[model samples]
Target chain A: MPDFDFAQPTSLNEALELFAADGEVRALVGGTDIVDQLKTGRRNADMVVDLKRIPELQRLEIEADGLHIGAARSLTDIAEFPVVLSDYKGLADSSVLVGSWQIQNRAGIGGNVCNAAPSGDTIPALLSHETSAIVASSSGRREIALSDFFAGPGQTVLQKDEILVELVLPPIPDDSASSYLRFIPRNEMDIAVVGAGSFLHLGSDGAVQKARIALASVAPTPVRARAAEGVLEGNVLSDELIETAAVAAVEAATPISDVRGSAEYRRELVKVLTRRTLGISRDRIVG
Target chain B: MKHISITVNGDQHELLVEANWTLLETLRDHLRLTGTKEGCSNGNCGACTVMVNGRTANSCLVLAAEMDGNEITTIEGIASQGKLNPVQEAFIKDGALQCGFCTPGFIISATALLQRNPDPSEEEIRTRLAGNLCRCTGYDKIVMAVEDAAAMLRT
Candidate 1:
């Protein structure tokens, strides 16, 4: 790793100013992925603006709107937060599943989304909740839906001078629940071969009022299974309907053959995990 | 170069370090604390595990500059007044280590686990120590050692 200047900015404005002054700069939070990237020469920067010191980026608040998760909050903190665990179980599940316990103690949702890996665990879960990313730059702040934030693998719509500030999730409706599941070769400390996250709101009539499905490790970015979700909307969840939605999820995936799994295998896992996650989400609503 | 203050093993040190130097490098090269072994250095193996502010973390993944104003505990800090910590004693008594290369990291991780959860079930112990990899002893003795350590601490 090459030597670079390091700045710990206490405020978002100061961080933005530092970022604007430096042409080649990277924001360091947990440094779990980026440090490794730097060691491997995969990423290079002249300065690293540490955002962990920024108070606003480390706060976690639950408001009337929903939960406001500070971008720099550790995964462990988010996973164990009472509000998150009770109201956003899928996010909590994905938070704890990001890495090992030690990694979770440092890694946060911000770096996870910013790194923008196709197999990132938190992404599909965030997308399932319809979360929005609050990004800040010298120009000002803007909110981008989590689904629209990712441009590609290892890329996002965030400008070089911009930093992700927080993730805002809308108020979870009554009788609504979500689940995130992934097929990993190992139980822990391994990336997902295929991941699925499902969020569903069941109406009093026992039909699906709303449904959101997101799949990971199946495309260049975490993708929404819109067609699969379309199958669930306004319909009672039956095994046959779930099978159809699962098939649609398979069709939605555009996985490539990698060492972890073949494209076909990933597509198959997508169907299986999609079915399983939807089943879990439905059970949460009914049970 | 970056000047950072860190409390390691209860001793405070102010040092000038290169920005790219990891906490592992700072400990081994600068502070001369070679007990924290570097196995994978990519966060895959927890050979460089240390307690940063009472929580175990992979020091290899943390930049030295980030250690500023942080309290760190390494394997060297586990002993007290020339006495081996209970976890270390249990490891020795249970024959948990063979090569001893991964011993320090496992000790640090086990100490951390016991600190947080005094009475950890076998499965809980396994889950907590999942990050640390030991090539020798096949982990059975290591698990027994942590269990024994928990019991010993309770008594």
Candidate 2:
């Protein structure tokens, strides 16, 4: 970690002004990733702005519209929040799996998304939930669909002068449920080889009224398995139907081979995890 | 240099820290608290685990400037008044460590686990200690130490 100026701005406007002043500034949230990047020379900063001090960025609230999760709120809080756990189980599951318990205590969902790792656990879940990011700059504020937030690996659409303020998840329908699953060689502390998240809304007749599937570690960014989702929408979920959709999910993936797994193996895991997570989501739907 | 005030192991210290200094470096070099070992310097290895505001974090990943006005409990803070903490006593009684490089981290993690969940099942103990890696011990003794520590604390 090279020497840099650190500023803890108490307000979003102040943080924005600091960011506007210097393009070399990086927002320090959890520091779980940024600190390692600094140490490895993967990233450098002349000035690091700490956003945790901003009151708005630290809030986690459940309201009529939906859940407003502050970008800087710790993963531990998001994972354990009763409303999040019950209403957004897939996001909660991913949140709990972000890192170990210690990492969860420091890492924030906002940082997780902003870091934009292709293997980020929260992105798939967020994508499935139709989450939106509320970003703020000195000039104004804007909301972007989380699905459109990431540009590529370690990249997001956020400008240098903008900060991700919060994530808003619209209320999931009463008949809807979601699940997130990832394949890892080890039980813990490893990045996902392939990750899948499914959100399903069952019609009164037990047919799939709507379906959303998202995957991670398969492309430059987290992706929606629109083809697989198309297979499920307006259809009944059966073993054969689920298997067919899983195959479509495999088709949706564009995984790269590396030390963790071969591209072929990742594609296979995508099918398996997609089927399994879809099943879990279907089972979670209330009568 | 950033001037930060922090409370560590029941002592208050107001110190000047370089912006690049991690809490691990500040603890080990500046404060001379060497118990918190630096293993990976990254978040992967838990050797530099410490409690910040009652939650365990990798000190290597935490900026020293962020410690201002925060309560930190390192390996040295676990014991009280010259007495070994229950987790430490259990580890010694169970011979849970070999080489001892990862002991402080494991102890701190187990302590935090017990603080949150006083009576954890064997599976819970295993999951809680997963972040702390030990090469020498096959982890059976470490698991037993945490269970015994739980029982001892309960009594």
Candidate 3:
């Protein structure tokens, strides 16, 4: 790794000012992604800013409106957080599934979203919960829907002078439950071949009033399965409807063949994962 | 280079380190704590596992500059005053190690787990140590050693 200047600012304003510099500035929470990227020459930085010291960016709390996840909070903190486990199981589930315990102790969800890998495990879960990104700069702060945050693989809409402060997820309504499932060749320590998350809100008449389905590892970006979501929006849970929705979910993907799996295999995984995640969500709601 | 203060294995040192040097390099080169081995410089392998601020972290992934004001516990810190830690003792008794390159990392990770949960189930032990890969020995004896260490700690 090449030598670079380092900054550990204690305040968000101070950190943003560092980002407001002339040369390339990299903000790292865990160093799980960026450190390797730098060592391999995949990413270059004139100045590396460590964001863990910033107070506001490390905040994790539940407000009246929703959950505010500070960018630097470790995956361990988020996975075991009580509100997350009870109300947002998909977020908790995906958080623990990230890396081994050692990696989870350092990596944070904010970094995962910002890194913007097409196979990022947490994005589909965040989308199911309708999360938003709050970006800050020396100028001011602005919030973008998580669905709209990515530009492409390893790219984000964030400006060179701006840093992501946190992610805010809307409160999960009553009669609702969410769960995430991914297909990995091994039981752990592997990237997702296809990941799926399902959020369902059941109506009084036993029909689905609201639904969200998101998939990963099947496109340039983690994508929402809108057609599958449409299939579930007004229907009750049945083996037949779930089968249809599972097949419909594959329509959102434009997967390419990769070493982990082939394009056709990923498409099949998308359907299987979508069905399983929906089943898990349904089980969580009534059981 | 940047000046930083870090507490390693109950000793404090203020030193200058290149911003690019990883904590693994700092521990092995400057501090002469070579017990922590660097396997994959990337975060994939946990061979360089160490305790940073009481949590297990891959030293190869952390910058030495970031260790400022951080408390570190490397494998050299595990045994105390010529007495082997319970995990280390159990590894010896159960023959859990082979070539032993990965032994230090496995011990550090196991010690951290026992500190948190003194009575972790076998499944819990396997899951917690998933980051540290030991290729020479099948995981059966390693798992047994952790269980033995838990019993040793309880009594």
iRMS, all models: 0.9, 0.9, 0.8
* DockQ of structure 2: 0.83
Steric clashes per prediction? 0, 0, 0
Which stretches of candidate 1 lie above 4 Å from their native place? none
* Model 3 lDDT tens row, B1-155: 79999999999999999989999999999999999999988877799999998899999989998889999999989999989999999999999999999999999999999999999999899989989999989789999999999999999
In the order shown, the candidates' DockQ scores are 0.79, 0.83, 0.86
| Global lDDT scores for all candidate models | 0.91, 0.92, 0.92
**Which stretches of candidate 3 lie above 4 Å from their native place?**
none
Full-model lDDT, candidate 2: 0.92
Model 3 TM-score on a 0 to 1 scale: 0.98
Ranking by DockQ: 3, 2, 1
In terms of lDDT, the poorest run of 10 residues in model 1 chain B is B128-137
> Cα lDDT for residue A2, model 1?
80
Tell me, by DockQ, which candidate is best. Answer: 3
Per residue, candidate 2 scores C-alpha lDDT tens digits across A94-114 of: 997887888999997888999
Error of 2 at B100 (Å): 0.7
